[model samples]
Target: MMKNTRYITATVLDGNRLEIETPDLPIGQTIEVILVIPETLQASLTLSDRYAFLKLPIAERQKVLSMQAEAMIEHYENNTEWKDLMTGDIVEYSEP
Candidate 1:
């Protein structure tokens, strides 16, 4: 199971409860919340972090480019046409 961490600021409420307002996560998912002192907490990266690899240095960029090219070549070599599973055959699909 992959774990995700989110940093949020919540207001302390009466009766030992806290209220947090976040817009990213959808409703109905189980989440674990932990309390930490504001001064000691560091915020996690946002969705933009996924593309941070594009910011890599020149040598790293070359490595990434080479890997992408290799992957494209391998895909073209091993790819098969889409088929109809129930009919057990390759079927050309046309848009009406």
Candidate 2:
């Protein structure tokens, strides 16, 4: 059997939820979902940092990312200071 594939970029919403829109696909149709965390957005690491991180085993890399996500969430939750410098629109991140 042949398979049709489509690629879409989506943002990870709060609570790790993703909202995918596939207008072409029929409603109630079964589709496979494979989440790819682009290296550029993986914890917002730098090029050199990502290179070093990619050296770790796959399992270890996952563990590290999970921990980083948890820490970031916790930091935001506990943080009370809102500096003027912190007020800004979120810009798309990319590696140089």
Write model 2 residue lDDT over 30-51, tens digit each, in one string. 9866455654666776799768
**Candidate 2 Cα misplacement greater than 4 A, ranges:** 40-96
Q: Please, what are the lDDT tens digits per residue for candidate 1 over residues 1-96? A: 555656455677899788776778789867765344332332463557436656767765665566557655666668644323435667799999
Query: For candidate 2, what is the total of clashing residue pairs?
Result: 0
Tell me how far the alpha carbon of residue 67 in candidate 1 is from the true structure, in angstroms, after superposition.
35
Kindly give the number of clashing pairs for every candidate. Answer: 0, 0
Best by TM-score: 2
TM-scores of all candidate predictions against the true structure: 0.32, 0.40
Give the best candidate by lDDT.
Answer: 2
List the global CA lDDT of all models.
0.59, 0.72
